[model samples]
Each structure stands twice: as C-alpha cells, then as structure tokens.
Target: MLQLIIRRLLQAIPVLFLIATATFFLIHLAPGGPFHQERPLSPQVLEALNAHYGLNDPWIVQYGRYLNHLLHGELGPSYGHPGHTVNELIAQSLPVSIELGLWAWVFSLIVGIPLGVWAAEKQHRWFDRVCSTVSTLGLCLPTFVLGPLLMLGLAVGLGIGNVCGWGSWEDRLLPVLTLGLVHAAYVLRLTRGGMLEVLNQDFIRTARAKGLSGWTVLFKHALRGGLLSVVAFAGPQLSALVTGSFVVETIFHIPGLGRHFVQAAFNRDYTLILGTTLLYGALIIVMNLMADLMQAWLNPRLRVSML
Candidate 1:
C-alpha cells in the first residue's frame, strides 16, 4: 500500500509539471495583462509593474524563474491582490472550499446511497420508479440552473433563506444542495447498478439459501461488494466537489478557493492562476490515487495484483 502510494506520488510530478507548463503559457498568451484596466496606465507605470512582477521577461525566462520559485516553495505575489502572496490567498480560502466540499459529499452519500440500495432491492416497484425519475431529473439539472431555481422557490418565493451570501446555516444549505444533488444522482445510479450486479451473483444466492434474513443478506453480505463502484467514484467526486464549486461559490458569495480561482482567471492574475491550477491538478491526481487505493482495498485480488 505504501509503495503504491509512493509510486503514485512520484508519477504525479510530471503530470503536475505538464499542467503547470500548459496553464502558464495559455494565461500569458491571453489578450490582456493583469494591469490592463479601464483607465490606461502611463507607459512608465506599466513598465515598472511588468518589471516588478517579472512580466517584462521573455516567456522562457519567466517560466524558468517561476519554476525556481516553485521548487523553493514560493508561489509569488498576486497581481490582482497587492501585498498578498498566492500562497496566503490559497491558505485563507482552501479551508472554506474544503469545508463546503465535505458537507456536500456527506449530503450526497446520505441521500444517494440509501435510496440506491432501496431502489435496487425493490427493482421494478413504485419506489424504484420514483427514485429513478428523480435521479434522472437530478442528473439533467445543471448547478447554475438549479441554483437559481432553488433560490427562487426556497429563498425568493417561499422566503426560506437569503438569496445570496454565505455565513449562516441557511446560506450554506442552498449551495450544498446545489452541488450535492447532481453528484448524488451519479452515485445513485452507480450504487443501484453495483448492488443489482452483486445481488445476482452466486454468493448472494448461497447466502439466501442459508436462510439469512433479508436485511442481513443485503447489508452485511452484499453491501460491501455492492459499494465497490461508489468507493471508486468517491475520490474524483470529492476533488471535483472542491475544485468545481466555482459557480456555487460565486453565486453564494462564499469565500472559497473556487471564487478566487474564477476571479484570478478573469483578472489574469498570472501567479494566482498558476497556483490555483496547479493546486487543483495536484488535487485531482491525489484523489485518483486515493480511489485506486480504495479500489484495491475493496478487492483483495486487485490488492494482490497491485503488490
């Protein structure tokens, strides 16, 4: 397990390098500079700002300099946010994103898994049909659309909560539900499929033949194997939840990394863009590694093969 983890980490170095390299050039090659604004700066001021941020350097030189700073654990200063390093901004915002992601994950699991298991158990019944229909709608609804609809119904029409801003539990509820429901739909489908497959296996028949109670057979005997797909999906889903909250964060005025990431891109804060991109890329790799580990743990044969 440790060897597998170490190997995955080692392999991530180049992947992250490629992501960073690609993002750096793409953002730099974009039409405007970070200092570009409605009011034109004096050429002297622009030149001074470029020199100060090393933006005046040749692309290759700037890349090399950025790489050097990266190797020494520096992410450089934020162009949009003066007097703040990219590192400090990320440090302030990452926890908020992480917290939001965790809440959404928990909501997805709680809502998705049980309904899926029940749907599988009840197969062509009314409950299954209802769940299937809801899951379909959930899958079809994009966050941007669903967010405002929810705000209209719950916040605007019903007067349930504030329309925007993130602070109280009410503020968090909409965002969490908006982010979680789509993923929950995915989880529901995966879980139902996995459980259906598992329940039809010969082992399940034998367990039934042994006269085990239905609940025991389902939960104890079949659930572990049934949940294999969900476990496999969990890592990437978690990372996506964290990094993909840009829309939700923006809508809710949440102070998270995603909001900053979106602002960085729009503002062309080169260092902040690179930092957030690399951070998200690294997160994706780590999450996939975790998924691989979880998959191996769930299947002993896979674990042995990994060894």
Candidate 2:
C-alpha cells in the first residue's frame, strides 16, 4: 500500500506540470492584461509593472520562474491585487469551498444511499418508480436553473434563508442543497444498479433460503456487496461535484475557490489562475487514488495482487 501510494504521488508530478503549462498559456491566450481596466498607464510605467511581475521576460523564462516558486510552495503574488499573495487568497477561500464540498457530500450520502436502497428493494413498485422519476428529474436539472428556482422558492417565497451573500451557515444552505441534490441523483442511480445486481446473486438466494428476514438480507448482504460500486462511483461524482459548484458558488455569492478562479480568469492573474487549476487537478487525482485504494481494500484479489 505504501509503495502504491508513493507511485501515485510521483506520477502526479507530470500531471501537475501539464496542468501548470496549460493554465499559464491559456490565460495569456486571452486578450489583454490584468491592468487593461486600469487608466491607461504611461509606457514607461507599464514597462516597470511588467518588469516587476517578470512579465518582461520571455514565456519560457517566466514558466521556469513560476515552476521555481511552485517547487518552494509559493503560489506567487496576486497580479493586480498588490500586498496579497496567491497563497493567501487560496488559503482564505479554500476553507469555504471545502466546507461547501464536505456538506454537499455528506448530504448526498445521507439522502442518496437510502433512496437507492429503497428504490432497489422496491423495484418495479410505485416507490421505486417515484424515486426513479425524481432522480431522472434531478439529473436533467442543471444547477444554473435549479439554483435560482431554489432561491426563489426557499429564500424568496418562504423567507427560509437569505438568497445571497455568505454571511453565516444559514447563507450556505441553498448552495449546499443545490450542489448536493445533483450528485445525490447520480449516486442513487449507481447504487440502485449495483444493488439490483447484487440482489440476484447466489449468495442472496442462499441467505433467503436460510430464512433470514428480508430486512437483514437486504441491509447486511445486498447493501454490503453493493457498497463497492457506490464507493467507486463516489470518486468521480465528488470530482464532478467540486467542479460543478463553481457555477453554484457564483450564483449564490459564495466566497470560494470557484469564484476566485472565475475572477482570476477575468483579470488574467496568471499565477493565481494556474495555481487554482493545478490545485483542482490535484484534487481530482487524489480522489481517483482514493478510489483505487478503496477498490483494493474491498476486493480481496485486488488487495493481494494490486496493492
């Protein structure tokens, strides 16, 4: 397991490099600089600003300099926002994003897994049909549409919570619900499918033959076997959840890395933009590695051979 983990970490270097390269060039590819909005500066002053940020250097030289900073755990300074470092911006905002993500995942699991179990156990009945229809609707509804409608219904119409601003935990509810519901729908479908397959297995038949109660068989046997697939689904679903929340965060006025990423792109804050991109990439990679470890643990053959 240690060797496997080490190998995965080592492999992330090239992936991070690609992410950094793509991010750096992609931001520059867009027209104009971060100062494009500022009152036009004298050419001498502009040159001085460029020199200050090392924008005066060639692209290769700049990339090398960025990589050096990255190696030393520096994310460089905020381009236009003086007296602020990229690390500080990230540090302040990351907790918000992570908080939102953790709540979203927990909510999805709490609701989705049970919903899946109910649907799977009640397959072809009204309960199953209702859950299927609801999950389908959730899958179809994009966050851009759902976020506003939820705000209108919960916050606007009922006055349950404020519709905008991240003032407190109350302010986070709508965004969390909007983000979690979508992923919950995905998990429901995956879990239902896995459960259905597991329920048909010979072990399930033997358990029933032993005269075990339906509840025990369903929960202990069917669900336990089905969990492998559920955990596998979680890795990619979580990555999607984290990435998709960018739109949700923007709409809900949440101060998170997603909003920062959007603002950095608009301002062409090259280092900040690249830093966020690499960070997001690393997150996805880490989730994938966790998935691999989980699969190995659940499957004895994989545990013995792969890990």
* Model 2 alpha-carbon drift over 4 Å, by segment: 38-42, 239-244
In model 1, which range of ten residues has the least summed lDDT? 158-167
* TM-scores of the models, in the order given: 0.94, 0.92
Residues 1-307, candidate 2: write the lDDT tens digits. Answer: 8999999999999999888988888788898986666678888887888888888688889889998999999999998578899999888888788888888988988899999988999999999999999999999999999999999999989988777788787798999999999889988988898899999999999999999999999988888677788888888666656643679888988878887777888888888888788888988899988987888877677788875
Tell me which residue pairs clash in candidate 1: none
Q: Write the per-residue lDDT of candidate 1 for residues 1-307, one digit (tens) a residue.
A: 7888898899999998999899999998899999998899999999999998888889999999999999998999999999999999999988888888989998999999999999999999999999999999999998889999989999899888776776888888888888888889989998999999999999999999999999999998888888899988988889877864888888888888987777899999999999999988898899988888888877777888887
What residue pairs clash in candidate 2, if any at all?
none
- For residue 66, give model 2's deviation from the true position in Å: 0.6
Give the CA lDDT, 0 to 100, for residue 33 in model 1.
94
Residue-pair clashes per candidate, as listed? 0, 0
